[model samples]
Target: AQSVTQLDSQVPVFEEAPVELRCNYSSSVSVYLFWYVQYPNQGLQLLLKYLSGSTLVKGINGFEAEFNKSQTSFHLRKPSVHISDTAEYFCAVEVSTNAGKSTFGDGTTLTVKP
Candidate 1:
């Protein structure tokens, strides 16, 4: 079984500022981690993922995340954020044994002010 947790429920930042959304997970088997962003009422968009290889993974819209094995974490970050970046972010974990099935965190709301 696998589960994910987004440490912060909300994060408010000003435009052009750096931000990080923390996420942690627990699982019995090896897993893949992913970050998704939802803009307003729109569907989720894939931000980044960590299936294998290097610990640092970059995604669309200049977002990136690092997979920490020892800490069991996958935190998303952006060096600079824009007002358009305001949205809800989700962290998910998929067990290697179970394909197409994922456990998602509650989500972290990122509010970027101008």
Candidate 2:
């Protein structure tokens, strides 16, 4: 089984501001990086992923991340944020080459104050 440390339980950000979510993981074999966003009482939506390509990967909603192999870190970042971006973010690590199992971070709630 794999594990992930979110580092921060919550992150408060103002409207139209920039934000970054910290994430660290521990694994013996290769792992997949993922960030998911969840609105109030909603399911998680894929923000971005770093599988096996470039270190820098971008996703929907102007979000991007860089996969660091040595540090075992995959941090999520966005230049600007909106009030609508207020949600709970989770960093997950997928283990198993074929059968993927997700181990998610506690959560980082981005409070985009209006």
Candidate 3:
């Protein structure tokens, strides 16, 4: 079984400020990590992912996350944020097994104010 945990329920930041969203996962075997963003009244979109190879992975909208295998962490970060960046972010983990099972965190609401 795999599970995801988002450390923060909400993060409030002013426009242009840097932000980091912490995420951790637990799994007995290898797993793929992902980050998704959901804007107001919109569907979820993939922000970044960590499947294999490099620990650092980049995604849409200037977002990036590093996979720390030892710590079982995949924290998302951005150098700067804008009002448009305000959205709900979710962390998920997928096991390589064919059971087609995956888990998502409760989500982190990022509020970017001007």
Candidate 4:
């Protein structure tokens, strides 16, 4: 079994400033981690994922995340954020044995101020 936790429920930042959304996971088995963004009234969009290979993973909209097995964390970061970046972000964990099943965190709402 696996569980995910998004440390912050809301993160407000000024436009063009760097931002980081913290995510942590707990699992007994190997798991795949993913970051997703949800715009208001829109479906979720894949931001980044960490299944294997390098610990660092990059995704759309100039976002990136580093998977740290030691810390059981996969934190997302963007050097510069825009007003358009304002959205709800989620962290998910999928056990390797369970291909499509995933456990998602509550979500972190990022509000970008212009």
Candidate 5:
């Protein structure tokens, strides 16, 4: 049994400021973690993943997240954001291998002010 919950559905911040999007999940077995970003009217792109190794994983556009086993969370963080960064973000999880079952959170809309 696995499920993902995105605490915040929307976040508004000014450009160059830092932000964090909170996420949590529940699964009985091991799994793969992923954060994807979708720009306005665009598709999603892989921002990062936690297949193995370090808990702290860095991703594109200066984004990063930490996999906290205890909390069952993988919250995304960005130090400084650009207006260009305004988009929808999703936290997703799947089985650890080639097995194909993906579940996405409703999504978090990030609004970056100019």
Candidate 6:
């Protein structure tokens, strides 16, 4: 089984500041990592993923993550963040196989203030 852990339950950042969301996973076999964001009352949207190929993966909303197999970590980062970026972020993991289902972290609430 695969599981995800988000180091921080909440992150506070000022507008235009850089931010990083820590994500770690545990799996016996190769797995896929994903970062998702959910706005208030909105559905979760994929931010980034690491399935194969390059260890570094980029996704929507200026977010990027590096897949570290040795560390079993896939940390999400954005050089600059906007007020609109305030939302709940989740780290998820699934086995590499198509039959795998994602296991999500508790989620990190990103609050951007002026």
Worst lDDT run of 10 residues, candidate 4, spans 93-102
Task: Give the alpha carbon lDDT tens digit for every residue of 2-114 in model 2.
Answer: 88999888889887889998999999889888999999999999999988979999999999999998998999999999888889999999886636568999988888897
Candidate 3 — which residues are off by over 4 angstroms? Answer: none
lDDT of each: 0.96, 0.90, 0.95, 0.96, 0.93, 0.93
Off by over 4 Å in 6: none
**Candidate 5 residue lDDT tens string, 16-110:** 99999999998888878999999988999999998878999999989999999999999999999999999999999997653778989889999
| 1-114 per-residue lDDT for model 3 (tens digits) | 788999999999999999999999999899999999999999999998999999999999999999999999999999999999999999999999836777999999999999
How many clashes (backbone N, Cα, C below 3 Å) per candidate? 0, 0, 0, 0, 0, 0
In angstroms, the error of model 3 at 26 is 0.3
Candidate 5 whole-model C-alpha lDDT, 0 to 1: 0.93
**Tens digit of per-residue lDDT, candidate 6, span 8-96:** 99999999999999999999998988899999999999998899999999999899999999999999999999999999999999887
| TM-score per candidate | 0.97, 0.93, 0.97, 0.97, 0.96, 0.96
Please provide, for model 1 over 23-92, each residue's C-alpha lDDT reduced to its tens digit, 9 standing for 90 to 100: 9999978999999999998999899999999999999999999999999999999999999999999999
Q: Which ten residues in a row have the lowest lDDT in candidate 3?
A: 95-104
Return whichever of 2 and 6 wins on TM-score. Answer: 6
- The stretch of ten residues in a row with the least summed lDDT in candidate 1 is 27-36
lDDT of 1 at 90: 99
- lDDT of residue 27 for candidate 3: 92
Q: lDDT of candidate 2 vs native?
A: 0.90
